[model samples]
Target: MNRGKLNGVAGTTGALCAVVLLGNVMAPDAHAQNSVTLYGVVDAGVTYTSNAGGSNQYALTSGNMGANRWGLRGSEDLGGGLSTIFTLESGFTIANGKFGQNGTFFGRQAFVGLSGSWGAVTLGRQYASSSQFVGPLASGSSWAAPGMGYGTHPADLDNLNSTNRINNSIKFASANYNGLTFGGLYSLGGVAGDFSRNQIYSLAIGYTQGPVKLALGYLNVRNPNYSFWGNKANDSTTASNITSPVIAGYASANTQQVIAAGTSYAIGSATLGAVYSNVRFSGLGATPVAGLSSTAAAYRGSATFNNGELNAKYQVSPALLVGAAFDYMKGNGAGQGGVIYRQFNLGADYFLSKATDFYAVAVFQNASGVDSRGVRAVAAITGATPSTSSSQTVVTAGIRHLF
Candidate 1:
């Protein structure tokens, strides 16, 4: 009962400790095995357009197939079905090694949240609920449209690609329940004494069952211009402004509201998608144009735009895909009426591997009728040159690698 007994007891305790430690490591749901992963995409491309600032042009570009950027994502299990998660994603231009999203390092996404069986709640910069739910239904946001911003819903006015990630946002995303999900987002305006000024919020719902998917969403922004581009202290305009000739004139509206719905169906190796969006810019404010007469109401009153899109994609094989989309838009408001736009997008991709692919895309757009300022609308793709006339065309070929 002396030395031998004590040594035996100690050995037993040491063995038990080792077993418990090993169990923690090999346990199916062990939290201590959490990890942080690093990932990124690098894309580059050559592009040419039938018109750019009134002339044909060619150039090198980045983020054509997908954005070029790096990110860190992590998840830490906390027992049960709960976990703590975080993401920091950055967008960059590989061509010149410049940060995208207006030079912010983590422009694409930066959020921390908790997850459980029910869903997740995230804080910080994030995509609004509308974009999160309905955007995927569009070909531009999906596979049919690639090469930077080529395939978005026109100038992406509906925020389908979420070019404008909500700042200081609180977002709630539901877990998939029988293939259905919903979410909401609210962005704090940070303006003292004015709860609504510069505020942004949205709600969205989506359903996915086998071969079909559908989504619907609504978004509202107060002091639209100020909310998106205004500097924090003075609400002064930022350097970057909306450049699309489609609705650029009306960018100063006090309020912007959007309702969007989309649906898609998969048949064999082909997928077809449709999207509709209604956008209204009310409480309109006059915009100061560079060359407009001081007395002219460049952008004033209220305006509305209706956009529709049809898109299809076919997987030719395991490594190849081809797709096309047609888009139409009509606008009225702020004294401008009957403005219309038509666009066509086509693209193809060949996968070299799971992490790399080559892609080609072309887009053409035509503008008709009056613009927000009662002038002929000009054709403008999101990242392309505004056509001197009513029509513009662009084509791009690129390669993207993911890690």
Candidate 2:
């Protein structure tokens, strides 16, 4: 249950329409030795933003807590203690037709893999470790959508610019060993003379036993230039990191990295979870402006952030579920410094069948950053950012189906 999802109007929308009608492989028609499945979420909602820059903006949005998308997945057994598995997932928007991430075909996921008791090794595009640990443990990821402040510190920061999925990468995930499982992923740069640039690596560990669940992860990305997605600077009350500025631009401290930890507990029909994250940004490769000393450049820039969250959910009934979440984040030194954001999210869903469901939700934010005017988030897919005001809100409703 990660915060960010892979289905949106990012370009694959055309394909999504065609695939939806095909229906996940025709339901294994008579005399067929092969089978495949199609699935998707059709979530559309009317949103109302309170105090949206002095005007209440009301509009329809998609992919709030979860993205609106359709996909195809299938597998065939080789009959030799092995199987061939593959998934081709695409993302689109019901509200509008726009390709996610600049028109990618399979922005959600496109991969094939071999699986067995020795764990699983997969290839192609897939989810990142950040989403595996930090995301589900936080409130914004589970509850905060478009209506709240951007999100927790790092606000899916580990998602790598909302790119929870990696391309041209090889991944390995081991089966649970007593209560621990590990995963690692690497992406080959595929470019000449830039072995380090554009390469990504992630390490993650997960544990589950009885009523306790826990996760820890680390991610590092080498960006040749500055990108808010990878090279974010985190600061504290007393000092600033020279590499990351609140505003966007290219900087020399091009390397980005993060460390995170999270935990959860389940008791009967209810469960509780919490997470803490420390994010840092550094300009190890930066060259200050001419005549500007490193010490001077350090003052105007730098970022250190602390993010914390608490979450809980109740089964309530066999066909219904309800949940609530709260999150907080603060930045120091940069434009976001003294930036404090508090978020609240509440929602419920009811299932009509095993494969169909409907849901409704609301998100609110109160903050002291960005001049106390507060910013409103109407869509979850735009990703999280600092708030512009001290208060904001968003409301949503939609439907989903699976096959």
- For each candidate in the order shown, give its overall lDDT on alpha carbons: 0.79, 0.58
| Residue 93 CA displacement from its true place in model 2, Å | 0.6
Candidate 2 residue runs with Cα over 4 Å from true position: 1-35, 143-155, 160-163, 224-253, 284-302, 333-336, 369-388
- Give the winner by lDDT: 1
Expressed as tens digits, the lDDT of each residue in 55-164 for candidate 1 is: 99999988887878776677788899998888888888888887787777788889999999999999988888999899888878766444377778767888887767
Clashing pairs in 1: 64-147, 64-148, 303-333
- TM, every model: 0.87, 0.75
Pick by TM-score: which candidate is best?
1
Expressed as tens digits, the lDDT of each residue in 39-140 for candidate 2 is 666556666666555557777766654565656666656666666667887777767776443356677788889877777778987777656655666655
Q: What is the lDDT of candidate 1?
A: 0.79
